[model samples]
Target: MNKRLYLELENCIGCRSCLAACTQCGGHDERNRNYVYDVNPLVNTQTMPLMCLHCVNPACARSCPAQAIQIHETGAVLSALVEKCIGCQNCTIACPYGIPKFDTEQNLMYKCDLCIDRSKDGIPPMCASVCPTNTLQWLTDEEIERKQKQFNVKNDKWVTSIHLENETNVRVNLPGILQGITKLY
Candidate 1:
């Protein structure tokens, strides 16, 4: 649990490797839980990976009337339990980053579970392991600190679009253009 997930927006090359790897995760039902987005499709090819930020007090979990979404001991906000899920779609609407997805046919809510099956044992998540550009990284606190210092980044925390109820577990280093902005588009 000492290792944390980290993202460097500038390092991503839009390869989609992380997305491909996500489908192979256990309990994922061959569906990719992560996403890659074009930073600005018209202007540049720079792409960024988007997944659950695993917020400290997740809105998704809070809004679930069935209380299906649970937070793991390792601080990962897990996807909804099939039996507990009520298909209310509250999680999809509550999340600030739009991370959760609802399967209409299956009547379920699914999001990034941070590969708990592997990460609980200190192994890197599948996305981080397959990222050839090192954009998605799994690192210890010490390594994260080193990278922050090396990049001259004052704060490693960032959010996409809007502020969440609290901070997220995952750390992100914004691209140079958005360095001080602290908001990811």
Candidate 2:
């Protein structure tokens, strides 16, 4: 049940395919609603994609006095019960990544579900599926570790960190050449 999403910033080609896919899957109006942030650090040529890290101790979950946020068993998925949300904006302020978006029309908060709906059909997430350079990857923790080790063997840098908040877990890292590239973004 230990799953994670991996981002290879160096491999990223600044494509917005993942962003488009995420918005489309979330809902019809989500296209302009969802976004993939592109940051190019002054020293780095590669672009870094910023999104929800789905922290184990999710600040958003704890901040949500309404208890609208929940993490699935796999630990990679975070969901917001729109019906339960009170539109307090606590989750938005609590989230360090600022991933949760406030829906002005619906008066609710929305963020990435990691495409849980698409997973029901045994499909990879929109971002991963459309990545031409294979920059974004989703895998179980064990699988991620194996790949990390392989990268280490090749003298690649594997920076890993974990944080827990509000009964949610967040694991993040940059691998290989992407490590330095991501920092620039």
Candidate 3:
């Protein structure tokens, strides 16, 4: 029932467009540190856009002393209120990916709010909307689970990402590349 942001690690061009687009959202105002990049846990070399995972059981919300973090009706976990946020960084410490940020000037915790206004109205978030390679998608819970299962990593913790365009997910597996970091060609 929940919608999630899905990523394709291979499609990332390292363009930083997602980061640029993030600033266009409401309340960003050159201060919100929203979009962030993260490396895959399974593959050290692979990078992906990192945001609030909107966990079913969110540690950030529970740890917020002010209880400023809110869960949108659509299941999106939003950024903490600047007025209510104490800049304690408790959520930052609690987050598995370390995605939360502190704005020293504003003295508030900043994290991706998932473009709450657009998402509720059925529009994709800025990052996903501007992804030229279709590497990011907004998908329902069932769609994400089904796609992830296709990777056959249900037991191995391999995450499914991107447009599902190319079946090949990792580049290091090729025999020639295994010999060295250089391209096989």
Candidate 4:
């Protein structure tokens, strides 16, 4: 699909609307898979959302001894299959971004699946749907390209760390400070 999820880090207002909406997604069991973090509590109140980037070659899936973590056709790395998951937690240790969450009681691993029920049908994920600041967005490739060009974002893929940079399905535009621009969409 041409339509995909996009993130504009500078636009997050720390409203936590995305978190609330995440719990409402089907099969989430009232738990939010994504996270919001204070960029710098002492320096500023800037907060950013973090979620599974859905790596092109997901370590989470690779580490699954039971092969429970499956990637959907849309490249969304889905949660561990209940029947197949062995509760080994290997996926958690293997992931670089620390996106997967373990349920101690249920002995299961769960993470953002890009709201497959909705996203697979070309609808926006719950978080993107409720974001008032448009921090999280569902946009077409053309729209993303236009925004990236407008913001002077040379790279559409998210940079996980200095040592390891994996290409991901979800595109991102870094904060203004990192981009050397005062405005970001």
Question: Which is the winner by lDDT between candidate 3 and candidate 4?
Answer: 4
Candidate 3 per-residue lDDT, tens place, 12-115, comes to: 55667788888888767754444546565466654556666666456788789999888787767778887789888898888765777877887877787778
* Cα lDDT of model 4 by residue, 7-67, tens digit: 8888899999999999999989899999999989999888999998888889999999999
Instruction: Tell me how many clashing residue pairs each candidate has.
Output: 0, 13, 4, 0
Candidate 1 clashes between residue pairs 3 or more apart in a chain or in different chains: none
What TM-score should be assigned to candidate 4? 0.92
lDDT of each: 0.86, 0.63, 0.64, 0.86
- Give per-model TM-scores: 0.90, 0.76, 0.73, 0.92
Model 4 whole-model lDDT (C-alpha atoms):
0.86
Q: Please list the residue runs of candidate 2 whose C-alpha ends up more than 4 Å from where it truly belongs after superposition.
A: 26-29, 32-34, 41-45, 76-79, 120-122, 153-171, 177-185
Distance from true location, Cα of 146 in model 2, Å: 2.3
Return whichever of 2 and 4 wins on TM-score.
4
Give the Cα-based TM-score of candidate 1 against the true structure: 0.90
Evaluate residue 130 in candidate 3 and report its C-alpha lDDT on the 0 to 100 scale.
87
Candidates 2 and 3, the one with greater TM-score: 2
